[model samples]
Target: MGGWFRENILDAGKLPTLLALASFVLTFLITRTVTRLIRAGRGPFRNITPGGMHIHHVVPGVVLMVVGGFGAVGSGRYGVAASVCAVVFGIGAGLVLDEFALIVHIHDVYWSEEGRQSVEVVILATALASLVLSGFSPLGVDTLSPDEREDRVTVVATLVVNFLLVLITLAKGKLRMALIGVLVPFVAVFGAVRLARPGSLWARRFYRGRHRARARAALRSYRHDRRWDRPRRRLQDLIGGAPDRAD
Candidate 1:
């Protein structure tokens, strides 16, 4: 185990990344728990306000991110300083992304339905970080032989092809597939060849006059949402608390 850690994590220069990802996940989870408790009036936590202005956690998050990011860049990626900067950056990222919805809407909607976007973004970030920790390299180059990796032409070609495939997958409205495809090219390829989502750019452009294809896409989307929406919502609510009911 120690040998594997050294070879795959430390030697590969992934220790800092792993540390940051772990810290991000931990900080986000802790933040969510505390916020939920505060919302329920069951904890000592209270909102921060100064000079009649409500101060959101994202303020400190941005500060920490800037300091840690510059520190990491300046100090290099080995030893204690790098590790500390990575952790700080991770904590800042967690805090910022936890309120992604608020940032997007520029409002205090922490408990509203729109706030669920924050949960979704956090989940996506966690999944991506986990993939990285699991040794999946972005752009799917990790599977190449050392010799192929060393060849500039081969590497560039592979990256370009994979990038186009990812773009196609995104156009098809398969965001999750596209994201995973960055680490696993085959997934992106599959999404590229599949039917586009009914409302996706790909469908609007290519399947516009194709009634049958549009019908199939719509039906598939409806069935998929029916099958997964509730379960997905339940999972999000379990992790981040339920959205506040409309008054």
Candidate 2:
């Protein structure tokens, strides 16, 4: 009996599982409360407000990174896997910038809007980076040998926990926007990269062609209704000794 228990549970060990559990619980509870608060304001908890939607959207992504990092270190994926997780996390931080921009645009709704948004995004991002680093590292399991199957408990738990974290963001209405917000920077940056390369020149040219066409249409309308024309017509009438300017 002892040997069977050791083979199943202790074979892969307990530290990784424990750490993942702790992270999952902490992030889940914290994010849920935050979402509830954002959806329902501070007064009597009865009032609904857009109090915390912005930061709540970002919390899950951060949780993933944290759990990934912890899995890397505890599972023994410390070499190249941890490094790759770090790089991806750096990219994720770049993604968070757009979210920050949105927060800036809607500052009137939040009290210390920028500060709160930044803190939440940064914390969640760090957690997610850690999880990725730990889970897929050499110690982790993104790559497995032909005959190998990882400890199913750890792998399954991680997937389930991350899914729940995401659901919290959606429990309110911001998940779709959060995903799009994260991807927007990636689209712009990758498109710019393609634009600079000669191989994708045709695609870039097509984009520019469309942009120029739109600009031309806008300019035509601007010239057709120039603001100066209105004032000039009034001045000309006054100089020509017509009726009063008011008329």
Candidate 3:
């Protein structure tokens, strides 16, 4: 375990990234717990307001992100200062993304169904960070041998193929799969070959005259959603607290 850490983490210069991700997850979890307590009227935690304006946590999050981002860039990659800055930035990111839906909608919907977007974004971010930490390079370049990496034609071909796969995946309306597929090419390949979502660009373009394909795709999507949605929501609620009844 120690050897693996040294080789995969320290030697790979991923310590700062690991620290940042850890801090981000911890800060988000803690923040959610406190806010949930406040919502339930079971804790000393309270909302912050000033001058008749309810101040959201995103405000401080943005400040910390800026400061830490600049500080880390100035301090360079490997050192105590950089690690500290990374942690600060992570905390800021957590706070900011916690209210991502509110930022998008420009309204207070922290406990609404739309607010679930924040949870989804956070999960996506965490997954991406974890993949990076695990040594998965974006665009699957890390899979190349040293000679293949040095070969311009090989590199270009690999990049072009990966890019097309990513585009196809996106057109299929598999946003998360497309993002992750940049790091793990096989994921993108699977998405690219799969049936597109009912309302996706790929479906509109290719399934226009194929009623059976479209019907199958829609049915599959419905079944998948039915199988996963409830469990996913329960997990989200367990972590971030349930949405308010008013929503």
Choose the strongest candidate by lDDT.
3
Over the stretch 1-247, how does candidate 3's per-residue lDDT look in tens digits?
9999988877777888999999999999999998888888897898888788899999999999999899888987788998999999999999999999999999988999989989888999999999998888889999999999899999999999999999999999999899999989999999999999999999999999999999999999999899999999998888787897871
Better of 2 and 3 by TM-score: 3
Compared with the true structure, the alpha-carbon lDDT of candidate 1 equals 0.91
Steric overlap count per candidate: 0, 26, 0
Distance from true location, Cα of 126 in model 2, Å: 13
Better of 1 and 2 by lDDT: 1
Q: What is the lDDT of residue 181 in candidate 1?
A: 91
Top-down TM-score ranking: 3, 1, 2
lDDT of 3 at 106: 97
For candidate 2, what is the lDDT? 0.41
All candidates: TM-score: 0.94, 0.24, 0.95
